[model samples]
Target: MFNNNKLALAIFLAVSGASLSGCGGGGGSSSNNNTTSSEPTWTAGVFEPSSEFKDQCALPRTGNDPYNNNQPYPDTAGSEFTEKMWLRSWSDETYLWYDEIEDNNPDNFSSVAAYFDQLKTFERTDSGAYKDQFHFTRPTEEYFQESQSGVVSGYGINWAFISNVPPRELRVAYLEDDSPAANVGLQRGDTILMVDDISIDTNTQQGVNILNEALFGPTAGDSHNFVIRSNDGTEKSFTLVAGNIAQTPVQNVDTLTTENGTKVGYMQFNSFLSIAQPELISAVNKFKANNIDELVIDLRYNGGGLLALSSQLAYMVAGPANTSDYFYYQTIENDKQPKSDPYPFIDFEIDYSNFEATNTSLPDLNLSTVYILSTDNTCSASEALINGLKGIDTEVVLIGGKTCGKPYGFTPTHNCATTYYSIQLTGVNYKGFGEYSDGLVPSPSPQFAADVKGCELDDDFNHQLGDNDEALLSAALYHIENNTCPIVVESSSAKQPSFTSQAIQETGLPLTIKQPLYKNNMDLTRPLPAKEGNNE
Candidate 1:
């Protein structure tokens, strides 16, 4: 869809002395003719398999090479695996076109993280946001284990820096059941007065860094102290040790009763993972049983995972309109077309989220309209869901902050130990549209231009999220009843540091893409459940 060309073609043709161009949308690499673009702020992100790829991409599965998982680790193992995988996946499979210089020179790395920096495929965006910000990687083992098992090890406090400037306060967003935070009586809307005896705030760089380490840098059995304030204005302190946290993606499922007896189902879908299917099914089935008139999907903190789940969730919401209709078309560079596939609404039984579960279809909500609660973290597959729903002409109401726009996604490929996640796919809806890097902002523009379905209203943080009276949910409820938006009344504009919810920051990793790996025995020829273009 863009004019940028010569990425994938540059690799193969360079050996043969020929030149070629790229195809499709979103990820196609454009020229880097700018005189100055800052060095990329790349970091290690988590790993998951891609549903659209079958190639090993890294060191050969049968090889005795150190870079291969079968062999012993080399001091240079990660770089070698990263280089090869970059050739197989990043260079060849990326939806974005690459320049000849960046395409052929893959040896510029002393570490895996450094190697990751060189694989980014966009010209520098100057407004302090990544026009092409989908680059990210993570420790392979940790991410793979967590994504597959729905578990993580940490303080278990889902906290957010709600203010951007001085005195940046950390507030509890929610708590995982049985987590350290939850065990210590910490709950949503609580304020963390101190972390590790270091007065935590966003005002100073040292404080934020210390807070980051205290929050995510520790292993199980590690302990940190925090002074917390309850909603009733009582303050207390506790020393909590870290432990393994089991994160259930569907955190809350309840029905809200309006004064007029209208039943609205509310579900806080945290992330898209294996556990999500069962949890989501359980919630939706209950909503269905209750005969819910409207549904509110709270994806405010969902960073996106598993394309299959995204498709499943979309189908569950749209039902018959989705049935045989196309959900998303995943496209790669021209050279790797064989690995590409289409994800339809009604998919055959394929293993998803590291488990082979029963049934191919998710229980459908079958609603004509869906209300989505969002934030900067509502990205990748979440945004893809919004795209898929809109493409099928389903009514989607977007409330809260603008969505973290990421039309791209990745499957974490690996060498030996380090899994390499390159931006290997650009997803489009049935009509084939995928160019929303800035994000699907909530605005009142035309459908295709403004991106999200409904009018814009910033989230209300006066109450905890998922509460019947929370800002975002209240807006959705308000709109559902009145058929118009509540006014964006003046409130504190400062927000905590959020990924995908806010612009690219110098202090954090850009978490723009993540999704499921292709099932090993996936049948590319699986037929649509209904006729093509049967949205009618």
Candidate 2:
């Protein structure tokens, strides 16, 4: 089922390459030169009229058709085969023709088999070649079964038996209606334990494999036995059928509250998908109505989505007038002119000319301070949003771990038949004050250190913090409480100064005089070294 070339094409386009041309001269004939202007022809290989191109191109004629004069042999089959053979002979010629064609462009070649053939001819070494190979193959049933069994075992779950987690202490995230999970009674925050007879182990890859087995069956309506631990701690067993699930990206909120009685607003942006802009505006309006004093945008796990959504969020936080204040930068290799100074890089400036505030009712929250909850998983659009916020002088207090270092974005292109590729041809480097590329590293202060140490001592470390503690959040809270903002200190100065030196500098008790009190033994208080000359 995964062998469908169209689906493969979609996946290929998600992460995909570039093209260049070279010329060679023919030794003997002007005929070769004349042929170059015309579309290149193809020759059929041993795999002619294979199942791969049956749907797209014509196949071997079997039955009589009126279009072909009621003959067993059809002209369409012959014509298609002739075209296929011509395409095979000079692949570049096919591409050239594809470029010239309006509807049947070469870029829209969406066949896996066609791409394979092209790769064999061009010998391209792009990453797409590897991914294409991986996706085209069909796995054996024995291989799949063993793989699933291995995953279940790794999770410390017995493949032949059922087990359950103790109830009442589990957190649940609900699967939406019509989802494979929803049909199985997998409500929001349902504490899952076992699928069929196998128990789940959180630390093992097998756990994920088992879930996939149950969730993605061979066909729709596939059922799986589930053992669940509900919120009330009751152990129950049920059967769930698999089906399609619609997933929306944005989660909105109207208001939040800080520890110091501060009424904060929140917008938990999960992704920059198609529905993000409208949802965000609606959420903002609700916050304005509620008189929110602060805004906390949680992007702790947003890995990114559409770039347009990122721009919209940036405009909302940074205001419409200051769109050009920041720019995203990237480095590109200019092979023709390799120089000593630097490579020619490009900068993509966020255009705010069309950003219109649909709701003029601005909230009570301080636009100068935007609390951004980040983490290592926060990447792409998340980074863009934070950078955009900073561009307009919004106090973007990033609260969490360092961001995922993936500032580069991609644009999609056609590779071959039914196969598309997304190439990371451009890089986004935010230019302006607080623009960063190494990612937002949390600067954990003394107080943050203390809180983490305390958590460790109490054995209450929350795994929800993932790899890093919520040090950035602590910094933001500190700023709100003490009215001191956190600054991005460079890596060179990450280490704190020595306590002895700090104490001496602060107290000024034992002063170390570097120079003589009076030079040349001049009259007492004579002009004081002309002011500028006094280094101290």
Candidate 3:
């Protein structure tokens, strides 16, 4: 589902009983037009087919789309009510938890986005977290730019927010090679003190807006100044200009010789983008050539991308002998459509840039067991890889904290130039298991299928990733050699310099920087099941 080529997607969609929507450019209409006494009223449960109101935009776009071969815009003149109704029907039809959603009157909502936001089920998981936390929307332009192009306008730095209170703590998590942050010598664990003269710990909403915009804002060539404190208590300043950064999905591929003379392959895999196909193939081939006795993949920061790429990696690890069956089975809304075909473990190399098979047999390590370095940031397709391999009895030893719980995915359906993502499908492994909504954890004796055997270690930012001394990677190596998890104790005297200011609250919003909903969710690009004689 992570293809970047639009022409290829168009051909597939044409034959797959679906038509592409929202390819043109236009913003949402400002006409709220609240329901008046003379206006038509609707019952809560009563609905129409989403196609009835599809592309009926309040402010229809003009002119042909330059991105889509100058195709005419599909939008037609309508009201916000029509747009909202389209979203409501779409949710009722496609949402995985449609029964749990509260049917609200579309006329009561003011805008399409507001109504779309409330369309998701408000149910929570047993862990007290929202069951459907991945619901969101983005302009079609923005979605395609990031998803299709795999290019983002940023400083090439992934920030880790330890806290987000008055005494907020932000640190440099990692950087892309030749990135603005890496070019300026910013290393992991360096605490950010100020951004463009605004203190990171500032309590004012205005200050928060400025800080967020300067750090996460999406605009090329936008310059911002930053002040950071190093791990050794050294203060430094830098000016970074944002640019289009194409991420190096795979990095730090190396074969490490353990103290016991066992060869282990280690690589820091950042994302599952299309560009990852060739890189991953190269890395696996190197490992295979080196005759690595074991493999350790650093996925602590990989928020996942394409499912195909994930399946490809799994095939390389397990090989065709073990992966001759379905990788996973996708289940959609009950009775809405027929059961989908199982995702097979891909064995041939794919030019994911165009979603085509290269016809070349993938190099396999034939490893029965693999060590995966993970954290809360590891999610979606990354988790799918773990579940897929485990389905075939492959031992996936997870090292580090629990993964970000996400077993659900959706097909990005666009309408009115806005790409809306709602939970539509729940994928399970060949073993018919996918209930890890609370997240997969590491325990000596895992009670549930989601739990794996490994150690729960803290992410050590003191050392560079893929380094021999790094915490998570080191734990994996030690586990391989000793056949047991090691007990790691931290030095008491080592403390990061905190902001010299008063704290507003005892805690902060969250530990990690908030990523876009797309980054954390799986995308389904294969043909979805449609009703008989109906194309979705």
Candidate 4:
């Protein structure tokens, strides 16, 4: 969701110096004795079109046509004209609409124009502010504004800075199948060196801009050269032609496994889009059919999607009755009471009874443990799933890197123009006993660097760890085989408080609390704490 305060701030910056005018002026040119002055010709008030004006404005114009002329004015020209109109409308009353403005007259044009100019400036500044706030890069000609569905498809060309091991490189974390980069063989984890001819030394806005310029433009189909460093440390150059690429948000069941003679099911959730529910259900059912003893959910690169889906997945894994208990939510009270001596401050408890009553009901798998693989790419809806699962007493052993730390979500709203935009606001904080605003920390497991030289003789060596490495998987299996769930006895003084499930529902807070699991495993506690050679 877009932040309203941020938008307001942008507007303030954009129109800081603008002046306000009020009421009535002559519409026609009038002679003034003062050589330096001329009569104003517009009026003030909100620009509400008259029925006649609406009829004319609503009609679609064709072939480079402008409303005032046969040819459409350039962007720069139109902006200048709009500013002039705003000034005139603010000064003259005649410019104000008869029905819209309360104090209508000829000289109100200047006020109206001033307001309009301020509005435009506000819009421009807001756009800039939005980009900066989200660390988003401006889209170039090669970049296309994808439909909402496209974003869900796991193919959205959105890029975010992520830390990689050993010389952290600004890599392509997500690539849609239909995107030009994907078409040209760009894959997640591919280290980008140069776009067009510009080198990417820093993962800053400027670096992203260079990428946009190289990959997107009016001449989209034109070929451009890219220098990249593959995961295996080999550098290669490729000439790619830019084009529209389809994104796939969800990936179906890839494989299933059994650990310690116990059936272990594995499925990679690539995205949290609308289509993910059915796919997930099918995967889970298949695992059940296979009598899987454990499940490994890979969300290392899942960037997140619909909140409904996250809840739905939680219900499927942890059961309906437990959903509310497993997640945290709160309501914001805008009204503030004035401070006084011994002023009483009350924080109201939010009731989540309605949520529990409406969502789908399902039984918790109640597996011994759920192995969740995560990385910096896991965000939003993905984080929600993790938070929700942990809230319900489900054993989730996080493996891999710390999450991207995106707890907020957004809902889109449309304005007078059909052009819709999203407002990003903090809705709920999913504190599951462990307050996780810092980031989702993973548990330590076995770590290994591939010994490629040992398997070079095999032709399939290149494809073995082509996509995801097996180190994390191997570690999970190792623990399952050799280690029992580590139990820690707390001192009597350190005894924790436990609340009933009902209490959790009423308060929107989890009952059970525990310290960070770092004591059991150090490596998994905090992103393998930057080693001298590690790049991530």
Q: Which stretches of candidate 2 lie over 4 Å from their true place?
A: 1-191, 201-211, 216-220, 230-234, 321-366, 391-393, 414-421, 429-439, 445-479, 482-536
Residues 418-518 of candidate 1 have per-residue lDDT tens digits of 55455545667776777776678776555555466566665555587677777788888888898778786665663545433343354433221122121
Task: Please write out the lDDT profile of model 4 over residues 183-293, one tens digit for every residue.
Answer: 666665576677666665434555545555554331435666779887688888988764444456545354444344756667767666444545676776677677667
Q: What lDDT does candidate 2 reach at residue 444?
A: 36
Query: Top model by TM-score, which number?
Result: 3
Instruction: Estimate, for each residue in 1-536, the C-alpha lDDT of model 3 and write its tens digit.
Output: 22122111111000001122322322233444332223223456776798987887777778996555689888877667778778878888888888877776554455677778778777789878778777877788776776666677798888765555656777777888888888889998898999889888776667877887888874788999999999899999989999988778799999999989999999999888776778999999899889999999998888777776777789999987787644544444446856665676766666544555554778898889999999888888888888888888999999998988888777788887888888887788888888888788987678877798888877777788888999888889999999798888867743332322233334432222444346775777644222223221
Q: Which prediction has the highest lDDT against the true structure?
A: 3
Q: What is candidate 2's lDDT per residue for 1-536, written digit by digit as tens? A: 01111110000001122232223211212122222233322221222323332222223334564322465532233223233333332232222122221222222234334433343222222222222111111222221222112111111111111111111122232233344454545443345576778655432356545654553332445667878776466878887654333333445464645677777666656555433545676776677678767777767646565444565465555543444434422223223212211111111121112221122322222356677766545665576566555444565666656665444333222111121212222233344322233455544332421111110011001222211223444455556665564454445413221224455445432212111110001000001111122231
Each candidate structure's TM-score, on Cα atoms with residue i matched to residue i, is 0.75, 0.48, 0.87, 0.50
Worst 10 residues of 1 by lDDT: 6-15
- CA lDDT scores, all candidates in order: 0.59, 0.37, 0.74, 0.39
Number of clashing residue pairs in every model? 22, 26, 0, 69
Candidate 1 Cα deviation (angstroms), residue 246: 0.7
Model 3 alpha-carbon drift over 4 Å, by segment: 1-41, 490-516, 528-536
TM-score, candidate 4, is 0.50
TM-score quality measure for candidate 2: 0.48
On lDDT, the stronger of 1 and 3 is 3
The local lDDT score (0 to 100) that residue 5 gets in candidate 2 is: 13
